[model samples]
Target: MAGKRTNSNLAGELLIELRRDDAVPLHRQIEASIRAGVRSGRLPLGSSLPPTRAIAADLGVSRGVIVEAYQQLVAEGYLTSRPGGYTQVAIGPEPAAEPVRTEPKRVPRIDFGYGRADVSSFPRAAWLRSIRRVLTEAPNDRFGYLNGRGVPELHDAIADYLNRVRGTSADPGDVVICNGYAQGVSLLVQVLVRSGAKRLAVEDPSADDDVRPVAVAAGLEVVGIPVDRDGVRVDALDRTDADALVLTPSHQWPTGGVLSAESRAAVLKWAGDRGALVIEDDYDAEYRYDRAPIGAMQGLAPDRVVYAGTASKTLAPGLRLAWLVVPRRLVGDVVQAKVAADRGSPVIDQLTFADFLSRGEFDRHLRRMRPVYRRRRDVLLEALRDRTPGLEPAGIAAGLHLVAWLPDDLSETAVVETAARRGLGVYGVGPYRMSGGGPGGLIFGYSTLSERTITDGIAMLAEVIDEVRAG
Candidate 1:
């Protein structure tokens, strides 16, 4: 049965449709229809509903059915009524409009997008073992809300690991566990802003998409310092009025250049002289192919550098686990900001990671994957040489990605567009630059791609480049 009622106060008429053959009670159907109408704004707030008897007569249903529906709705606060007053819609939330639809992003056939790890190599068995151990052995309090500094077990493990492996002079007390690198940077940005820092200098041709916006959103003027083959230009940075500088000194992003000893010392001296802070993003320092990974710059000036590290590159980005070794002076403020941003990282994950680290499972996993990544990197370099002879791949000494310099005459945009049309996803270095004039290049990430796939992708990219050059 269908019934319609017009209320003067409502913008439109309320319509109810009843399915007579369905097993659901007729009263429930009527109640649901009225609730939907109210929520969708067909029956506006304070709009009088039809009398029970009138609606019952209109729908050809028993008067008791209408009365029961009205009574239930009234009890649920969807309607209001008094003995002498008209039954009307009670105060409720504003109507929910239909959601806006957007086109889904297309996934390229062979994506060389950076910042992804080999997820297939994620040690599932070891992770499960750690989780099981945590669940079985952890104290009852381990499940409770932890302080923003994270669990002590994890802190101790990280401190020990960093000191022994990365040569960081980390203390458990100075570690602030965060969700990932992005959040760690965000939290640090907050502390920097709160400490009266007005400008933040980042490595130009760095991860601008990730770090710059975070600084900008926090009202800090972001300055771009040029990065060459030996990481960030310390001379250029010395000229900037930036209060803090964030650099990937271990293995620079995209460029893959390890900051030289002279540059590191110079930058630290500059920081010391200006009373500024340096943020060390130790990104992709684990899978160094040519030599032992450089020790974190934070160790040189623990009080001056805020070192950030993450498991995203080594294990999987899905874990969303990373940590910051903040200086003692900024520890309290960073912890407070972390609490305000997110009460804390998940306790279970932290406990599990702590267990994993203590047991040397993390070390074993890295040992196993390091050679695999090295092989892939070699394959990528070989493919570039064999297929794209004109392009010179730099920054291959470390990191998951490297910059393949395009010829001076080639337009980065044209090559990128042509590669996209061919279902080959290669990123150009043009977007990462804030201010610089240099030859255009493509950023090729090999971590997620297999050797065969990397070879094929490079061949495909070569054809695309040829097409672009011909045009």
Candidate 2:
């Protein structure tokens, strides 16, 4: 209802006319009011006219007068009748001054808009050194028709890396490289839906709006299962009907909470019982600051879990490389979908990345970045704590971004708008949101920030908060 008094949410508030003194004919008054509203551009062409009852109630006019006015307008080509809906303003009478299309561009002041790893913070020195060594040793044909899943070197490397770092037991051959987490999720969703699956369970307050949207578009129903501090609650999962469940077990988005052991066990048990699949998104495994890195949940229940990970958070998002470890049964369908989609991922980047992974360059770069990012995270924490007394950011456990909660009266979008006015770039934890009682906050990514920028940005944010409070 925010567009204009002209129209809002297609639920119009009409201006009608009636008479107490009888100075004017009632139908004539109504006609004049309608014409005035239309000519003033307050009532645009094709806007639904108010129901006769509504016009009568608002103006204290008889329905007959309003109906007569509408009928007159229709005959005059100002209004058009519909089967069961309100009378529409005729299309022909629109003024040239009123533009039909106007959509403003969005540029975030402090675009914390997406929860992604900042690649500019990447350890260039280590990566280049690894790339140099890899180039020297790599064979020429390594560039051609490599594994449809991934380059063999990187696939082997990822398997070894996951086993060592994430404790996943997935074989190298089982992993298929994708464009990103969303790509893998989309493909998997397609395969499942094609197999006659209908509803899929997902975290009620999870990130990744794209996943559910793809499912719904594919004629699959997405049921939101409640999530809590311990991650997706098993007891709360609706058992009515769902063929699969998507979860972020390592660190939940928006509100960062690792899945508890009991919940993990319960979910796995549920999936096992129903012959369902669990998609485990290990988005930010290496960014752990407070606890030991949680290994892949796929290791515990290999057949039931489809493990997905991405370079987006680890190395850089723009690289757009992700991989999924699926069950043996679904692997053929997923591979077919992969080939059918893009005829395989970009070969050069895959080979170069494979070279990067094997030479221990990925690890070395991670080592260099860890302390630097940790320091930046500390700066963010110190600034927020100092400037805003009671502000609390959730999910500091891992990842490039953290969510900072505002007071109940303040909204996340309002804070975002105010920040943009101040020329800062930031965003919510996810474009993803919930209907009720979801935490209200902004996603503050400190990785792309310099020491100077983090300090100045937080100070400016604090100032905006003060102004908003006073205003």
Candidate 3:
């Protein structure tokens, strides 16, 4: 009888084919199959192949043929192996084309970008301690899916902290944790739109450009009210037919003005009379150097005002943690929206932050950073006073940044461009305005810069202003 014919099939679903009658040797044929699989994207990079013994037994060939084929592919840079590890595909597929920019971006030597905190002071040790405690003490179920409103521990912690620090009458049941201020606003806007709100009003010349796009995308008409030294003008707000208003009462953006007491009362009254809602974005309320920060407006009328606060200013923006104290009637709607936006914010982070707040670590970190930021603000003001007397810094009593009025002779765009050419980063206020009638100015954020760096950047800015004026 003829000898038993050898099987031709390979195993482990590697998508390899063998030709028994071809003149080429079995080892070379196996190598070609693997090469074709890799080149045609069938075998992805970093994917492991079957063992030599398994493939040899399936193909009814000697193990040496399989070993030689793998060795050859390895030598050609298509496979990688170690003493005990499985061989894997080593080469990457061809790259796709990427879009090109008309002008290359320049990395500035002294950057004064706004909306950033001193990330170098993040209190990593305290955070690590909190995380360790959670892992050791928390129940196993804590790692699973959580309530959209947030965990009870974080809700209680945020409520207690806000009541004591921000003067808000927040109940744990009414607090909804969100990704950040951006998501907080987006969720609330969706709720408002669903409730038949047609128009929303915001501060003109506001630094927070994020709110407009979110509101518009959700099908709400956004109206702009002018802002002055006392914050958003109540007169302009009274004139609009807006069903809801969002403003930074404690420390306004870009302009850096605190809403006057009379105006705050008037705003609450306006909301009550019109049967509307007010969103109090209490961002950057912890760094007031002149005196104690003002209590949140939400304290006066909890049912009519929505209190929004975030860790981005006090801790770090990368945390993406924030809270909204909703009215009792609106809590359910907002939580439903939160569930739809994302199941909820990360639970581990929420628990870690709750532990951080409960142990008083959050308060201690803020106390340490308050003076550091205050000193940076003073140094920036002093440098501007000495180097560029023509520039006047406003809204310096609070927040991480302030706006300086540029002289009438120098154009805002011209000064910003000329400063960029000198390796300095400065932003103009005109772009933040809804309608253009205000004086030209530049916004300087000093929270992330050292005192020495602030001085040097101001000196460079002064020279750039002079050059622009001469031309």
Candidate 4:
């Protein structure tokens, strides 16, 4: 009886154990063991239960005991008996495994980290209206899988908007909508590397951090060309064998140098001579405060440039909306890459954004946000000038953030960590560099902070800086 067995493999797998030495009755022990299996998901929904006689014979218990255990489970809804004479598990417990929970770490009260948008200012009423209108009016076909080139309506809207605002020659056919700027870079890098391109040049002390690793992962070498006040040093670019260049020409990130007209022309000339590509990251150009925004370098030579733009700064990063203006020759390959990445972005969001753009709400939102950000930028500049006389803040003329070059002796990490301890959030530009060595500087983003918060955070940051400088 102790060696009793069954032909059922599942019965063998369950290996139900009975404790005869314990105080519990045999029938009760069998019931408890099977019940634990069901609750723990060791017994799956719809799995056949061994026949009562077979189970009783295998466990060396009386057949009536097995029948009673089965009856109890059936009444408890854990097993279902069918008219066809099959008894199976009725309920399956959810898997107990989950990511372990931990205490939330402390966050700085005022975070100056870049790439953050003011979620509170996200024009919710306008967005909701756009969503409703799209849902009400979109054809049934709009919900189906789409071409990788994106929805034609969004392509047309983006083409018109960029042509008017960024001065780029974008034919509607040449635009490919992507999830965001990050995905756009990934797609482009994939295409470029597969096409036999070997090296890419990124501006040092640039916002190229996110894109560089993507390119390198695709088996291409990324070189760092130093950027000066006028933008990426083209004179130095001539020395590297880089086959493509990713630049923030309109407003250099972290550095804020608008690629000079001279530098812009030089880079294009360099590309043309080498038959190379220039990726123009036209990020945050719409927010320039001191002058009329510089026209996108893509406008100068669209055939040689790939223009990238995003709503991350203009609207919200949560929107995950961005577009690329590819040269006609590269459109097909870029579209293919996009399709393979995710079969294009979500269609409903694309349609909603198209509606938003067509209704002029996108432009209106930008207009409303410009003054608010400009005032904050002004406050930041003035505060830095008044309290931190030794630090020089540059890139203030444009973009949501600027870089303040610290004194040579002060380390960027020391100031950043001290500021965090004081409940202020800010970052150093050192991580953005491709190489270890660069100027000692800190980057501060003002788009998400209010005027009062900016003033207070800067005051606290100044004290931290003074402490770093003193010690």
Clashes of each: 0, 9, 0, 0
1-471: candidate 4 lDDT, tens digit per residue: 242232365677556788889898877887888888889887877778788888888889889998898889899999888665767878988667899999888899988878666778999999999999989999999889999988998999999999998899999999999999999999999999889999989999777757877988899998999888768898999887888999988788778887888888989999999999999988888887888878988888999999999998899998899999999999999999999999999998998999899889999998998999999899988888887777889888888998899888889999998988898888988888777877788898998888888888889988998887788
Score candidate 3 by lDDT. 0.90
Clash count in backbone of candidate 1: 0
Cα distance off (Å), candidate 4, residue 228: 0.9
TM-score of each: 0.83, 0.73, 0.82, 0.82
By lDDT: ranked, best first: 3, 1, 4, 2
* Model 2 segments more than 4 A misplaced: 1-109, 123-143, 238-240, 429-431
Residue 194, candidate 3: Cα error in Å is 0.7
- CA RMSD of all predictions: 8.3, 16.0, 8.8, 9.1
What is the C-alpha lDDT profile of model 1 across 112-156, one tens digit per residue? 988889999999999999999999999999788888899999999
Query: In candidate 1, which residue pairs clash?
Result: none
**Using TM-score as the measure, which candidate wins?**
1
User: Residue-wise lDDT of candidate 2 within 192-294, one digit each (tens)?
Assistant: 9889998888887777576888988999888877776667778877463689998888888756778988778888888888888899988887888878888
lDDT of 1 at 151: 96
- Which segments of model 3 are wrong by more than 4 Å? 1-103
TM-score, candidate 4, is 0.82
